[model samples]
Target: MKKVLILALLLISTVSFAQTISGKAYYQSKTTVDTDQFGGGEMSEEMKKQIMERMKSFLEKTYILTFSGSESIYKEQEKLEAGSGFGGMGAMMGSFSAGAQYKNLKTNQILEEREFFGKKFLINDTITNLEWEVGKESKQIGQYLAIKATAVKKIDPNDFEMARPRGRRGERGRNRDAEEDSEKVADTTQTESEDPFDQIEIPKQVIVTAWFTPQIPVANGPGEYAGLPGLILELNVERTTILCSKITLNTKETESIEAPNKGEEVTRAEYNKIIKEKMEEMREQFRGRGGRGGGRGRFGGF
Candidate 1:
């Protein structure tokens, strides 16, 4: 009877521990932009400085990740305003910002809430697990002893984050004298003139360096990062680096881990297609209004 009682108590304790396991991690995310890559035509150094100042808020942001053992929700913390003098440029940059992202390790599902130019979309997709190679390297992140891991993360070829401004616009007006002589020439001219994304080469993959702590014992991290042995404390992806600033585990107050259900449901491919189309339209509008400014806006410019 004593042995049976001990086994029952152990089972009960395990259940209790699993039920109450939840955590909140605060991360400060920052991305560096090279202003030198954004010089439009005759833009002066002072103009570049002013542009960097305007982009400061977008380059740096705070995010909160609330997670349970199997699920997590990551979103940017609310702020009163992005920054002072954030005009049209802010709105343009904000279009690339992602909304709340929900991840379910148990279900192998990833859902993201994205808004592009006032159109809300719920991207429902299966999580593509990355094969992380754990290393012997270790470091201290706050009070946690984190282990280093690296992975090669595939990115979209048209990823705006990695885009750089072109030195000049693509040459257009092919077969100009012929005018309506051939439909092929008109189509080629439009393609060369309107699609600015063709100018810059965006990398297809980037090296991801992550530091995770087994002390947390949760396969979760900020943004679309996971599949680690523990919660990720620091992540370095190209120009962006996200570091966990604070972590609260097993608190009396547990935030709900509900997946975001709002917005029009769309697959990841559909969403990317929509964004590409809208981006082209926005680029044309910018060009029509500001001429060479649109070329600068392709990557980090206004």
Candidate 2:
């Protein structure tokens, strides 16, 4: 009986030690798009190059994941800004992008802060348990020995980040006034026109490949990814690849791990619906501008 009690005490101590461990991991994320499909094959190679160069600022990014054994916060790294003519557009896009995400493995919960235009939304949802198929492949990423794992995840159709330019604009466009209230945003009928933003397409599903190291012993990673046996050092989903560039473990100074409290609270489903309605509104606005000779059809005035 005493031996069994001692064993139980050791297990408890191990768990406590694991929970006390904390660190920050920095990742570089990059996404690529096919320039040939930008404008129905009408754009010159030079034009495509220029567009890609302009998009490089938005496509390539750096993120930081501050994590413990059971909790984590992932957010994009802030950088010094240079003067630009598109500052307003940049600010709008920044809000549209995913905000800080907090995950708690013990509670199986995720809290995400999102901003649409000028409104803020706090998404409170459960963490999706991805069933990863671990493979025999092993590789060295930085100083960590990582193993291969893959999973198939359903793509969120409303995700603008995953959009890829198709061949041409669609024949129909939806025109609606953008609503400030989430409840007022509804799926409604549309009018017909040549909508340039319709050229972008998002797939239904994607295969995700991840590399994780057991040395970290944490079931957390950057973005909305988790449920692994270790910290994910690399992730590849669709056209984006996130690679961890550096890791600082068990620092002398630790950050407080807590969920964001700002913004109107909503479920994941509610947030998706809200974003969809707003995107439809923007599409119509661009379509109208294009019809009036003020719109650059390729990438909505890029």
Candidate 3:
């Protein structure tokens, strides 16, 4: 009888511990400028329209993510450009150039795609870094216990450089100068002097923060993020924030979680190689124009 009682108690404990809770997540993120300049340089109306159009194009891209032990599904919307330029005509121009209706307005989109156990969901980029901490526990979010957490992450300043692509002209000129100096030194048998700007590296950084709930017991959060005790239902990274506006628990149905088949996953070094190759391809495409500023008119009077 004692053994039977012990076995029953163990079973009860297991069942109690296996209980799953569901809830929404909320987070606050603060953005910091790491570059010397806070915003991009002045651009003409046409140039701005063109840039906005490209941004809208990027908004069309999408991905999927999934989680374990939960029936509630989450989806992330793509980022779209917002705001008007000069007047209604400028706004109309922006809308027509981007091929999108004003109804679809998204500022930023998530970049990471995740899959688990045959199901896929999009990662929310709104959450930068997800961390957990002990605090005054609350039972506001369903049967789940909740605690507040915070995390900070830096944004890549090179994103602006890539978007502008103007500094490359200066870099190409320096390369030409170095080549000329090499030729001169070889012809005259004189040592060549180092270029003053050759060793300088540009500084860039942006910081973001987030809050998380650890009751769900999974270390997965959102985007290229993990390491939390529960699934991240909300995120606030950069100027964007995603809140778990709704959630549903187990019903009469079951859903499988699966890993997403992201094509051509590569290491950091491999990605860099791809970027370098693409940049070279672009340079070659516009070679005769003068390399970076080869065709000034193409940049649209920036």
Best candidate according to lDDT: 1
TM-score of each: 0.73, 0.76, 0.42
Compose the digit string of candidate 3's lDDT tens values, residues 160-253: 2122212222234557556555544443321121211121222343233333445455444444454444545555544344444344444233
Q: What are the clashing pairs of model 2?
A: none
In order, what is each prediction's RMSD in angstroms? 10.7, 10.2, 14.6
**Model 2 accuracy (lDDT, Cα):** 0.69
Compare candidates 1 and 3 on TM-score and give the better one.
Answer: 1
Could you give candidate 1's per-residue lDDT for residues 91-118 as a string of tens digits? 4555565789999877889999986655
In order, how many clashes per candidate? Answer: 0, 0, 19
Shift of residue 150 alpha carbon in model 3, Å: 3.3
Ranking by TM-score: 2, 1, 3
In model 3, the runs with Cα more than 4 Å from the true position are 1-65, 70-148, 152-206, 214-217, 251-254, 291-302
Model 1 vs truth, CA RMSD:
10.7
Which residue runs of candidate 2 sit more than 4 Å off their true CA positions? 1-17, 79-95, 167-194, 251-254, 286-290, 293-302
Each candidate's lDDT (Cα)?
0.70, 0.69, 0.35
Question: Which of candidates 1 and 2 reaches a greater lDDT?
Answer: 1
The stretch of ten residues in a row with the least summed lDDT in candidate 2 is: 182-191
* Candidate 1 off by > 4 Å: 1-20, 40-46, 79-91, 158-201, 251-255, 284-302
